[model samples]
Every structure is written in C-alpha cells, then in structure tokens.
Target chain A: MVETKVSKSQTKSTSQLEKPPSLMRGLMLSKITSWVLFILLSVLAVVQLLPLVWLFFFSLKNNQEVFNLSPLAFPTEPKWENYVTVWTQGNINTYFFNSVWITAASVLLTVFVASFVTFAITRMKWKWNKLVLGLFMVAMMIPIHSTLIPLFSFYTTIGIMNHPLALIITYSAFNLPITIMILLGFYYTLPREVEEAAIMDGCSVHRLFFTIILPMTKPVLATTAIINMIYNWNEYVFVNTFISSDRFKTLTVGIQNFIGQYSTDWGAIGATLMISIIPILLAFFVLSNRIVEGITSGSVKG
Target chain B: MLYDFKKKGEHEMDKVMSDKKVILLYVLPALILIMTIVYVPIILTGYYGLLKWDGIGEKTFIGLDNYSKLLTDSMFWKSTYHSFLLAAFSVISLGAYLLVSVILSGKIKGSNLFRKIYLVPMLLSSVAIAQLWMKVYHPTNGVMNRFLLSIGVENPPLWLADTSIVLYAIFLPIIWQYAGFYILIYYAALKNIPESLVEAARIDGASPWQIAYKIKVPLIAGVIKVTIVLAVVGSLKYFDLIYIMTDGGPNGASEVMASYMYKQAFRMNDFGYGSAVGFFLLLIALTVTWLIRKLTATKEEVQY
Candidate 1:
C-alpha cells in the first residue's frame, strides 16, 4: 500500500509540469506524428501476423480448395477433418509423445544439473570457480552447427544412434551454459543467511539444497525449464540429424517429413504445425511472466 | 568448557572446508559434460578439417588443402557473400523496425497489444515460418503474385523460382520472423529512458522525430550494437530456414555457409570441405563481432 502511494505520487508530480503555447503546439505535432507512426507500426504488425493467419485459413481448406481458391479466402466448408487426418496419419500422437518425453527429460536434467552447479559455485569457495565460468562462456561461442557432424560421428561410434537419450544428452549439454548463467544470477540474489542457518542445524549439503535452496529458487528454475523445454521441443536441425528412425523422431522432424519435395499438403502441414506448437504454447501460457523475466534478464546481460 | 570450545571450532572449520569440496563436486559433473560435448567436439572439428575422410571412410592426412580450397572455391565465396548480404539486410531492416517500434511504444495507446502481436513470429519455429513463406512465395497461385496481380501489376517475378530473387525471397521470412525480437530489445531499452528527457525536449520545442533521433536513438545505441552483432552471427550461421524453404535452390542462389557446408558434408560426403567451410564461417563471425565491438566501444556505461 505504501509502495503504491509512492508510485502514484511520483506519477502525479512527473505529469504536472506545463509548457508555453509554442512548446505545447510542438508537443501536439509530436502526438500527431506519433499517431501516424502507430498506424504504420500497426500495419507492419498485421503483415507480420499474415503468415500465421494464412496458416489458419489454409488449414480449414481441403487440398482442392486450397490450390484452386484464393489463398486468403475463408474456406467454403471448413474441413475440420484435416486436423484428425493429420493427427492420425502424421503419427503426431507418437511424435507428440516423443517431443514431450524428450523435452521434459532434457529440461529436468538441464535444470537439475545447472542448479547444482550454480549452487556450488555461488555457495562454495572453490578456487577454479572463475575458470569453470569462463569455460561455460567459451562454450556459448562455439556454434552448434560446427559440432553436429562430429557429435553424430561420435554418437554413431558409441552405437547410441537413434537413441532418445542421446538427443537428451546433446540438448542438456548445449543448454547447460544458459541455464547455469540464469540460475547463477538468481542464486546471487538469494541471501546467504538461510543456507548458513540450515548448515548450523546439521543439514547435509544435499538436504540443504533440496529443502531450502531448491524451494526458494523455484521461479528461476521454472523459467529455465520452460525455456529449455521450448527449445528442445521446437529444435529441428539437431533432432533431424541425430534421430533418423521414424520411431525416434520428435514433432519438429516428424512435421518436416510431412512436407515432401514434390508437394506439400497445406491442410496437413498446418495441422501438424499446430499440434507441434501446442506444448510450447501451453508451457508459455502457464509460465509467461517468469519466461519473460528470465529472457529479458538473461539475454540483456553481458 | 575450554575443551568443548576447541572441539566445536575445529568442527566448524572442517565443515566449511567440506562444504567447499561439496560445491566443487556439484560443479564438476556439468563442467565435464560441457567439456566433452562442446569443447571436445570443436577441437575435433578443427582436427577433422585437416583430414581427407568421407564420413564413413578411413581418415587420411590432407594438411591445409581443404582450407586452401575454401580460399579459392567459387561456391564457398558465393555463399559467404550471400550470407553477408543476408546479414546486412537483416541488420538494417531489423534495426529500422526496432527503432520505429520503440518510438511508437512511447505514448501510444494499446502499444502493449502491438508488442505481443509483434512477438508471435519469434515464438513460431523457423521451419514452420519458412514453410509458410514457401507457400506464400509459390509461383502460380502464391499470395504474393495474387496480390500483385490484384493491384494490376502484371507479370510479377517468380520469388523463390527465379534464381536472382531467391536469396532475397528467403531473407524476407527470416527478417519478418526475427525483427520482432530486436524490437522487443529496443522497446525494453526505450522503456528505461527517463520520461523527463522526452518531456524536457518537448518543452524546448523539439518535435517527436527530433526527439527520437537525437535523444532515444543515441541512448539506445548500445542495444543497436548488440543487435548488429547478433544479426551478423545469426545470419552467418543460418541454415534451417533456408534449408526448409528452398534448400539453397534455384541454382544455389540462396545458399549460406552453414547450408553449403551441410550439403558438402552430408550430401556430397566431403567432410573435409565441410569442416573448412565451418571454420571459415567461425572465423568470419568472430572477426565481425570483434570489429563491431571495437568500433562501438563506448566510454559511458549506459545503464538500462
């Protein structure tokens, strides 16, 4: 309540200053220019949204209707069956499951590993902590594309080719640096007194981490988990290169196969795209605030 | 009492030391994981670039032959040039869009709604966006041509089908998808600008365009630098969108280094050549990022 009153007062004081007539007119002209700018931005925003909107309209049309009719026109008959057809024939149910399992496992592993590492580095006085942090920063600079072939070769040599766990491991490795960086930032913000008190109460390091630190860091963990889950679920190149078998394919790769070189079934493609994005959308909706905070904080920092 | 105190003090110190060790143990697992997956693979890529091995065959020493070939390879040079063009287009367009959006965000009604809508494309997978654009750029019945025809512009050029326009055509979807991200960056930066500055400028008879250019742009210059660096790196390493949309098609007009490398390694089974391409890409990205940093290095620390 006090904070609200302070903010309200600040806002009031900030808006009270007046200007001369000429200055007011300049401000008015600025307002007019701003409105013009707003309209132009709105138009551009609509153009940006056009593709997704087009996807929805095309999804409702059958192949014959899609090819023959106007691309932007609403379907004469909304073929809702296309959704079912794509779901069934595209093996999206299995792909969805694969995506879920891979994403969930990868997120869980990455967050767990990253948090543990962050907990250790920030809490423990290790001599090589700076070195370890530097190593992770270097890891971020190495583009994943450069390493794909070598990783595939190594995975094939190990005979874990087409294994879901292999993909999970790869995702976890790539995701670790970002997760660690985010969790480290969160951990830094945490007070040391609680952990110190826990230590005095004869709490084991493991118990302390599980009971106190983990619970306190839930928001950051959730953000990291969701971000990792989104990336893993939507990732195409690695999954496509690593997982060859239809059984092991994630939704992104599975959906890609729907679009052959010869022809693309628009309805099926749209449905598959929708199905593939549902998990990410669901996760985003649930954790939108945390995700937004995490991205802005994480990406903006050096 | 003295014996008890001594024992307790030893126990506390031991606990401190043990806790430190435990922290190391916690960090060790992740450090090892990253090293094996990231660092080792990079070193191996460099090593493999020095060898002449089909991915399936026995490795043979090739020294710097692959790297030398990359220097002279027309296709490699073409793709590099194309990547630079794509990066330049993405940077300029994205920067412009971001600046416009940031200015609009100030004192605009429903700006929050606009921001949310603007960011939707960023949320969609690149492959999906690429596929959607491929449909939009279709030759006979594509939306682009249809719109052009409706506007009475007959004989609209084929987008992806035409060799000349294919690279730019592929770039359109990428720019559309990524512009929102930079806009958000600029928006966040713009929001950090003190309202008093704008108000003061207004009271001094400054127009909005002048305020935006002379005030907001200068303030958010740091973000612009970062955006340019990210754009350069991202475009240089771009693959999925192009691969999905055109597969660097219409006589390889849309090929970038990463896609070209993928074709070389996977399609042609020329692992050495692919590695060279990858190395060149890495070299260029790092050099450009460094150059931008050096150029944009500022004395004032603008807190945002």
Candidate 2:
C-alpha cells in the first residue's frame, strides 16, 4: 500500500525533473531493507509506550500481584478501586478541575493576545513592530528560573503570592513569545487584500480584526491553542511556586504531593500518575496532527 | 477613474491600519504582559541578587558580595558542571534522534503512526514521567532490575541511589521523554526537503546513506543548529524531572544549576543567594544561545 504511493510520488517527481521518461532506478529501498527499517521503528514505538502500558497494568493490580507476577502480566482481577480511591479520597478532583480551568483560561488568554500581537506586527503598519517582535523573541530565550525570584518578590509585594492569578498571568506572559511565533508564519502568508477591502468599505480596525482576521485565523489559532494547552497543562514550576493551598494547585504539583502520601502503594501511585497524564494523552490521540504541525511550525522558523 | 479609486483605497487602508491608537489597542495588551511579567522581573532578579534579605526580611544592600560568593562557591560550580554534563548528553543524543528521523522519514509504511506513537511519551508532564521512571528504576521491583535479574545478573546497580550512576540513570528517562520531540522536529525538516531534489540525487546513483549524509544533512543544517540550541539551552534550564526524581539528591550528585537555585530560594529561604544563582543562569543561557548561533553562522545561508 505504502510502496505504491512512494513510487507514484517518485515517478511524478522524477518525470518532472527529467524531460524524458528514460529508464529510471527505484527511489525507495528494496523489500528486505524496508522490512528491516519497519521492524526497527516498531521496536522504538514499543519502547516509547511500554512504560505507560506497564503503569496501566500495575494500576489494576494489588501489591502482591505487582511484585510477584511478571511485569507484563495482566491482573487476575483489576482493582478499579485504585482510581476510585484516588478520586474520592485524594485531592485529585480539585487538582483536575484546577488544571482544566487554568489550562483553558491560559490558552484562551495566550491565543487572543498572541493573535492581536501577531496581527499588528505582520499586518498593521507600525515603525517599532520589528523591535517589539524582537523583544518577545528574545524573551523566549530568557530562562524562567531567572525571573522566579523577582516574580516571587513582586507577587509578595503585590499580595498575590499564593494566588492562582499568579499562575495564569505568568503562563500567558511566558507563552506569548512562542504563541506569537507560531502565528507569525500564518499571519504573514495571509493576503493583505482582505484588510484593504474592509477598510475601503469603511470598517474600523477593530471591526475588521474581530470579524475578519480573527475568524480567518481559526486553523493556526487551533494549533497555537493546543500548544498552549499542553504547556499550561503540564506546567509545574509556577504552580509549585505560587499556589500554596491544595485547592488551587494543578495536577502537576498536586500529583507530586498525592504520591508522597501513597509512596509505598504502587497501585495507588500508578493511578495518581495516570490521572495526571490522561488529559494530555486524550488530547494527543484526538489532535496529534495539529500538535505535530504546531511544534514543527513553532520551531522550524526559529 | 478605476486607478484613482484604487489609489484612494490604498491611502484609506494605510490610515486605518497605521493608527497609533489602534496599534496600541492591538499590541499593548500582550506587550505590557510580557514586559511586566517577563522583562521587568528579569531585571529585578539582577537587583535582588545584591540584597541580603531572607525572602521576607529587611533588605541590606550588599553589592557584588553574592556575585563574588558565587564565583568561589564550590557547590555552585559543581551544579554548573552537572548542567553542562547534561547539556553534553543532550547534544550527543541529537545525533541518535537524527538517525532515527532519517530512517523514519524514508518511504516506510505506517510512518505517520510511528511518529505519533513516538510522540506519546513527550506529551505527558515531566512530573508524571519522573514518577513513572522512578518506579521503573526501583532497585528491587522496577522493570529495569527485574529484567536484569531475570537474565541472571545478580546486581543491577541501584540505578538512582548510587551517585556514580544516578546522573546517567536520570538521563535515560530524559532521553525517553524527548526522543520523540527531537525526532519529530528532524522528521518534519527531512520531509520538507523538495522531493525533486532527492530524486535527482538518486538518479545520479547516490546510495541512500550518501544521499542522507551528503544531501539531506547539509540542507537541514539550519534546523539542526536550532535543535542544538534548544537541547543545550533546554538542558541548562532543566529542573522538573531531576527535581522530582532525585531533588538533585543522594548527596547532590545530580544537582544542576536550576534545581540548586530552586533549593536555595524556596527550600533554604536564601532568596538572595538563589537570586544570584538565578541571574547567573540567565546570563549563561543567553550567552550560550548567542555563542551557538555565532559559532554555527554560515558565510552564506544554506540557500536551496
């Protein structure tokens, strides 16, 4: 199935590059080599996923089973109670909700602001546009640890030290550079005629941007939003540093503390870790293409 | 008539788009956020390093003391060494990622599925990865030791407990977590190369290895340089996994600069000293980024 597609593309490319369809050599590997490479890739795929599979298995087993049986052995009877206990007894529910809301709010804030900024820099005429863009790009290189001390001090002075607002603002700010970077490529490729026609028809800048530009950029916006979602969802340092109370903490930090109490219980620990990661894994399964596209577009232009 | 109207439209378009008020409305929300959140705090970090306050105490200006102290601090230097070691490991691993990407980008079946599968580990949070790997490295019950013991090996080298092997042990998970990411990046770059270019080379009887080495590699040199910068700088700032897995532990054998700074500030409450370390980390990151870019700058851009 794949070989025919490969040869079809190769034939078209070769015929395009060469004037005559003279005798041509195969552009792909032979059957044996292809099989060898395919096997190697499959091995890597297993290596990448084996730990998670093992975790899921152990999560269903009691201590005796986890210890006595083969690592790959299925539980004789799955202990679904591990998941139930963590959800009901531990602070997993609070952390899960906090993670969801905070991740959503940050993604929304980041994408909205980044869209405007990218639109301004790429579409709207401004003299300091390049300089401002440079500032954001340079900020991408600044280590968050460098800002942690001052940010902590600033939050303290402002009396928001233990606030979830702290995490939201920092996530949005730290993420703007990358979000804008991804949007920059898409914005640049957009035709200027749309904005020109809207202005010619007496539309205000805000009107045109809100109605036309915003909707036009939905695809790239989805990419940046997913990228932001992954980042904000997985973020640990800010949540660990700022939010003190369990109610405000996200899954990343919450799971750390949750695991501390259940240290010796492999099944409970496995459940806790799985709970922390399931949201992201679910998103990846649904939107793997956009995530790949987002990451590639985000970094390649760097 | 049509030309004049079009010219007038252009003039009207410029007026609306270039309005300063509108520009600020568009740019300031994000600009202010970054400035106050990112830029301002960075400058303040440098200032905080000069104080002697214990996070919440009255500040006493102690100019250059913290900086000078950092210069001679053995722990600071040791942590910095560990950071560079991680950077070295990360950079070395890029070669492996590139090789996998080169093969995966070939005309292989289920390449898309393989790429996505490789990316699964990367999507999980570092804390999750850290916890999972800590279990995987458990001396008695970990999958690692179990496999070793089953194969007739008596001692499996307490992976994270022994100082000599802890750093390397932690690095294995780092490789696991990021292998998909770098491979995805390289694969994307390889796929971007014009199909016609590769076909032309193939017709000239270039072997696959020769084509990959001589053609594909040089063309993607720019992406390779970017990945190098990402890996090095990312490693320098690396804290989460190590912090979770070891907390730079078993007597600080695996301590890196970021975790060390984190401990000094948050754990030890020596905010001033942590600021000093933090500021130094910033300087090192920026300098390394610039250094890599300068070193890899070609006389002429790789123009395809």
Q: Pick the candidate with the highest DockQ.
A: 2
Over A1-302, each residue of candidate 1 has an lDDT whose tens digit, in order, gives 67656654654466554322233445467558767888888898888888777888888887888878888889988988888987887777788899889889998999999998888777767678788887886676666768877887899899988889789989999999878877878898898767666766677888888898999998888888877877787788888878888898888888888666225677877777777766656766666666666665555554
Write one digit per residue (lDDT tens) for candidate 2, span A157-217. 8988888889999999999999999999999998989988888889998899999999999
Q: Lowest summed-lDDT stretch of 10 residues in model 2 chain A?
A: A19-28
Candidate maximizing TM-score: 2
Q: lDDT tens digits, residues B1-304, model 1?
A: 9999657755664577356568767987798889878888777877888989899889999899998888899988898899999888987896587666666557777776676667677777776777778788877667888889889998998898888889888888888887767777678777878988878887787756687888888887877787787788888888888888878887888888889989999889998778777767777777887898899899887763
Can you tell me which runs of candidate 1 are displaced by over 4 Å?
A: A1-24, A261-264, B1-20, B196-207
lDDT of 2 by residue, B7-99 (tens): 999998888889999899999999999999999988888999998978988988999999999999999999999999999999999999999
Give the fraction of reference interface contacts each candidate recovers.
0.48, 0.88
Q: Which ranges of candidate 2 are over 4 A from the true structure?
A: A1-29
> What lDDT does the true structure give each of the candidates?
0.79, 0.91
